[model samples]
Target chain A: MSTNKIDPTKWVDKYSDYLFNYTIVRVNDREIANDLISETFLAGLKSMKNFKGEASERTWLISILKRKIIDHYRRINSKKGQAEVRIKYSDDSNEGDWLEEQAPDRLDMTAEDIMENEELGLAIIRCMENLPEKQAKIFKMKTIEGFDTEAICNEFNITPSNLWVIIHRARTTLAQCLEKNWF
Target chain B: MSKFKSIFVDCSKAGNCCDKAQYNEASLPEKVKMLVHLALCKPCRKYSNKNTKLTKLIKDCDLKTCTEEEKQAWKEKIKQEIALKDRG
Candidate 1:
């Protein structure tokens, strides 16, 4: 028997940001990422009946998104006719020196760095899932969105002290959760 | 004893100040008290270090959230698709 169940209505609130962050980095365009995510959500809905309760909803959606991204590249590649490879040797005098210079700087994000950051980002969001609904919302507003204290207080109808308490709890929980895997 | 009491803050209060300081929201006096507490409190200092590291990790991760309008648009699309499926 499957251990997980699908709930389409809550997918946006629960996974949109995770999906957006995952897609934006892969596609490198906001509009294209958004469109792809929209398509992923629709595709997920179509396949809802096929979902076994084995994997969690987020994991299942991500699998569909991976295929969507692959398909996107496949479409673009087909439109470009044949594959082409280009190499540059602007300075013959320098020989191999220019090629070495053209290599990525040490400070640039390597494929490994990108992969680690992606995993870290997703892990943080996953830790957030363990928080109470209200605490997670407030923490995201305060920490991620960078809303002002008074503004958040007014929106949530809570005092600054209450907000701080919630933020403290959220931070403590997140730090503990991440410590094992990330910290 | 009384003077020390004025500067002394419990661990929870120290934690609150540390959390506020992470966001640059702690007042100077609050920060001073928190620091004084950390100077004498071993666990609070450890907690403060971990808290600071957590803040840096969060900042370094560079996570982004979608706007409310974007989320609403997605929700609307999902709702529409579900409704259409029902009719079809």
Candidate 2:
């Protein structure tokens, strides 16, 4: 009888970044990605009654987002064979030479590598959620956003020394959380 | 004794410096003091190594966040929809 509850109110704060990163890498267009996420949220709300609460809210939302992404591709694909043009290897001239061009580019990531990095990103976000709210915010602003120490201090109304202490604590906690699986 | 005290830092200061160094924010003198402490302290060295690895992993993940304006728009949509459902 126990099930995870869903809270629409907290969705933006809790999972928006995770979902955004997941989406942008796939869609590769900021505007399209934003639209897809909006649609996903709307769809999730409309289907709220069907949710059994068996899965976590995030997992459920992600399932809906995946559907939206697929639908987007399907829509574009159905429009005048636009998808066909994206297949560069389909051209007849490169018949024998295509395989050579398929060799992995040194600068690009393999699909598996990209997948692992995505998983790692999600893991870090989950660990960050475990931190106190202020600490998590400060850590993200400093480490992820690359804000200057003085700038952050002025925003948070804290001194440089206080900011460093917070950063030190946040880093230590994050390291411990990731030690077993990632470190 | 006073000169030695000025040159050497304790573990806590070393940890702070290590964290700052992860962000490339530590001054050269601060880094030198941290290294001196790390040389003599086993646990601190371990902490430093783990901290460095943590920084690298985070950088490699390349996580991105939604802008506040976009997040606000989503939140507004969700709120309006919720209000409509409640009324209906």
Candidate 3:
């Protein structure tokens, strides 16, 4: 709301926790996440004039933060100069180290059942990360974006039939991952 | 599973998990499909819905804002910047 354009100070006061939690949720390393947060705010200040307020300020800022995190990983991968980075955006996923195992009975659960099942919820997030690239894209498009068929096909460059295949594959993979890992 | 001669999809496109229509048109054919694999298997239906609900809850919720210490630090930083701006 300041006349001077991007208010780094305002963004810091407003969304720092959101940004912190968002980065920490994706990047496990505290120092790396903090560095990314700082850089996101720094970059956001530089680009604030260009933001144009099309999306919510939060979305704009988070988009910058996410891009920065992706860049961080890219830098590390390039440093190694490997074929590709092993980082599948799955690095922060919690493994089985946290909780005592019970069973895969969540397969028989409803929304209420699983939310109450916090362990199961964490496991499901991990399972989502393990999905194949195409399948993960489909699931994210459908489940997260709430996109209908035509839009998704256009975004992913596949026919509706192919879209169906991808979603099916993703659902199957998710089910299996949940059963084996967290269920 | 029995493969059909391709329903409306002629040239044998790769089979999908389930078509979008199956999600809605609960016609006999839709019932013949798996979204309702639940009425036949309520447990699995329960599981699928559970996942959907969890995702919705997370996506549609409030995200917490900056903390007290963070706010204080931000104010102090802003004050320092303003002082420098005045001096300039």
Strongest candidate by DockQ? 2
For candidate 2, the C-alpha RMSD (Å) to the true structure equals 4.4
Rank by DockQ, highest first.
2, 1, 3
> Candidate 1: which stretches are off by over 4 Å?
A81-108, B1-4
DockQ of each: 0.79, 0.82, 0.15
Candidate 2 residue-wise lDDT at A22: 83
In the range B1-88, model 3's lDDT, one tens digit per residue, is 2355222332112123233333441245543544435445555565556445444443433222333565576556555655665588
Q: Provide the lowest-lDDT 10-residue window in model 2 chain B.
A: B59-68
True contacts kept of each: 0.73, 0.86, 0.22
Q: Write the per-residue lDDT of candidate 3 for residues A1-183, one digit (tens) a residue.
A: 333334556666456655765766567666677678777766765565698756767778889988999999889878785565342332356454333333255567577753455444444544565677567657766765467888888988889778776776676566666555443
**What's chain A's TM-score in each predicted model?**
0.83, 0.82, 0.42
lDDT of 2 by residue, B53-77 (tens): 9998999889887777999999999
Highest TM-score against the true fold, candidate: 2
Interface RMSD of every predicted model, in angstroms: 0.8, 1.0, 9.5
DockQ winner between 2 and 3, please give it: 2
For residues A1-183, write the lDDT of model 2, one tens digit per residue: 539898899888888888888898889999999999999999999998888988889899999999999999888878965434433566687776766587777577778888898889988988888889889888999999999998999999999999999999899899988998998
